[model samples]
Target: MTKHERGALSANAPKSGEADLETRLSRLRAALDGRAPRLDAPFPAVTLIFSVSDGAARAVTAQGSGATVDAAWEVAVTDLHRKMGRRKLRGRFLRLDWVEKAETWTWALLRKRLREVKRNYSRRGIALEKGFTHLFLEQELNGNAMLYGGNQISHCVVNEKNFLIYAQQKYGSGITVDFADDREVHVFDTAGLFCGEDGVLHELYGAGRNAGRRKIDPLDVDTLRGIIGDASDFLAHQVGADGRFIYGYHPCFDRQIPAYNALRHASTTYSMLEAWELTREPGLLAAIERALEYLCRQFIRTAGDDMAFVVDTGDEIKLGANATAILAMSKYASLMGTDRYAGIMENLACGILHMQAEDGSFTHVLTWPDLAVKERFRIVYYEGEAAFALMRLYSLSKDERWIAAVEKAFGHFIEKDYWKHHDHWLSYCTNELTLYRPEMRYFRFGIRNFEGFLDFVLQRITTFPTLLELMMAGRKMLDRLKAMPEGAELLAGVDEAKFEQALHFRASYLLNGHFWPEYAMFCRNPDRILGSFFIRHHAFRVRIDDVEHYLSGLVAYADYIEAVAGSSDGAVRA
Candidate 1:
């Protein structure tokens, strides 16, 4: 029988809320007396409701009722998916069913049922326990916890006994699961005012309709709040005076980076930015200042060169991913209208410029004991990124030398030698290149093709039948940026289509491909990953179980953190 059926029956014939183990057992016997004939008749499907309202509650089905909770669950959950349509999540169960058979209605059986549900969701890349505040510690339950305010968990998946104890310790009462109806289950606390599924907390404290318009999922937001709160707690608990953050616990094994300082700065800065945009919150400016102070101190003793790489220990640089971080610092500097970072910016800019070869191409790494030219294969991808950075700096400083340097470097991208290397899929590079040098007509040609690619992605999203089609659309977009025009003002009097195409292409590729993934992961593990990662690298694959698909998210988050904290963009501050 399905858990829903059990819950329905249980609700009709329930145990005591406050009765001790023995009394509850006695009450169970008494309640079953009238229902004995049904119990002896057949093992009817029972519906279960795991409600969280007032002090650990439960509603079991009538002893021998013939309710099919499984069928009820399938119908209800399927309906939710159909109703939700495009926003439907992969593994989220709109309804639940019970699996374990309790020889008798006991709390232990309920606990076992919860674990089974948790496992089912976990396989779909959902971490049910991670976002649950009660599972973590008692600290989160008191006085306005952020997770409680805007947190969510898909469902419970773990040891039910442990979960109960955790809840009891935090709330001073055990959890109660109630079957509200054939379609819904509710989790309750002491007052029963707040419910895990439908109590008023979400409507009261969560993001409202504006959030839905912004494409923020209510469930997703709640889950993120938990992850973010947990991360914040972890940092507060582990960070030393030196600002080094430690993660010597489950899931990660032993992988750690010296990034807490940068991460905290980035999250705070991003929050402030969001607050200013979302609310007229005036305190964010002060928060940014405070964040900047911490960020500046972290880098005061470190050399400017090391600041660009993800894990630079005095020498060598990891350029491609680090470029984004550098770009962030540059954007922040321009936004803040402050040149306090001028000294650091100058050093990194010079270092990057020095790395460019006479041929105009650049490598992923420029410094090493053995000057292996093989290690310096013309990495067109990062070369284009660095060029974009140079262009941004020129825009900011209006330095003639900077313009001359970019023009020369851009020239090499179009040469017959370079053009042949990219084939037909080089347009992605030019989309970014156009931003730096829009004056040249030849570059405008490349821009046109890139714009075409953007239209392609849009069409695919609309017409394509599968996720593979979407990915192919992305490939088509990236493969067309082979070469660009020589001058800087290529788009000076161009039609809207050209610019619009470029913008759409970037919006799809960068925002969907990079930004979404990072945000999803940050929502899942906010402490280590941070939300800026989501902004920097924002896209997730069709099903989240594909963890390897997280490279872009990881790199993007790293770059975002660097951008927020560092004085300037890395070796190339653009």
Candidate 2:
């Protein structure tokens, strides 16, 4: 008659015992369907990075003078070329024909073309040399210290030389060009430099605290030039025989997809045009086409349950592995063209949707094989992460379906009241999720109160049967039933074995659930490392930031108290 008595008897009822089974099923279903009441309300931070776009496309909406250095520099080059009476000698943009020619042509001919250009530049003196050296040097010297680490320097150098030769052959050596370490040299912004937080120098020159380093490094004009050169060269040409850029990496899923480093090189080749300083390199349009094709193949072959992606098995069960791959695939598909991949992307999105739990948590594959849900689910950070990706997809396609899916799935954070906790785990977990939502739109992500989120989760575990205890209890009961005489036959009628599947799910959820040990973000700082080897401190830090100052532990405690009072545990445990 009581709720406690009702829940207990419900699980014990025979499938053929219509009244008891119906009563149990009805309560369980009602618990699931009951209005998921959200108590507190307030505004919060809106977090999400805008998607990448070409300068020309972004320029339309981009505020400011609407001037790019490449454009200005191009005009300057034309003027200088006319001054030298060699206006027709500029480098032919590297087209697909050139790539094919280089692929098939021996280094001997490529070398010969180089010698002839050198001859012309030498004759033109500083005017021609200045243009050539500046253009080529900048390409060779620029680099991203964060991405390539110490390797950025070497990458820039190789790409620079190649671009120089290509430029000489197309443009008569009438333009001057050269490169040097931007740090050691002085350069000026023709349009006057922006000192604002999101200025060009800040973005390209490495101003602000390098999230890679806690210290802020102001952008140097020279460094910006070098970075632009390095980025351009890396993006434009194959640095070597492997058909890769300077770092020989791809920009997609920096950690998840295999050969990501190489793929990054490839992706940046196309994606970096807006950021890096450079005119349209002769071969860039074709390179963009090729890069997109390669990227598409990478996505199709690796972003699913049976794909060639990183964390494809039990080996690399880190937090964002599968979801990151899926995110990359969606972005790449949208950027390339939707007509070809709308259906496949929809299916992938659907698969992830099916994995959601009643509590709004998701399971990583570590504990459960795949569909096992015996244990109470642990919050997997990826659920929140994948929601960001979904939000981004909505932004790109303006698809109502994608927006709806993101709203529902991401709304889980509020439903579970998971973001109110404070801890490094909550910091990293919630930061990415909240980044994607519209400003102050969601209840959970509404503001900074992560301390509250952590308190709520811990309070719930202490107040009620913890997720692990629930799993153990559920399993124990199932085992007892299995041991009964004719238990197998009886179970067939009630589908006890079918119900037992939740155990595996529960285990998997526990294995993959989110925990905010300091280790989620950085490796070097001893404070950031957790107890898991699969999760490297380095990977965490490289991927996200540490936002602990703005968290609320108080809110999390409140949620815990509520779940304890309302759930089956209230009757069973109390």
Number of the top lDDT candidate: 1
Alpha-carbon shift of residue 289 in model 2 (angstroms): 6.2
User: How does model 1 fare in lDDT?
Assistant: 0.32
Model 1 misplacement above 4 A: 1-311, 320-326, 368-374, 377-381, 415-436, 440-574
By TM-score, the best candidate is 1
CA-RMSD of model 1: 16.5
For model 2, residues 385-485, the per-residue Cα lDDT tens digits are: 45654555565566776556556664665666654432222332333334444233341242233222323333331111133223232233334445555
Model 1 scores a TM of 0.41
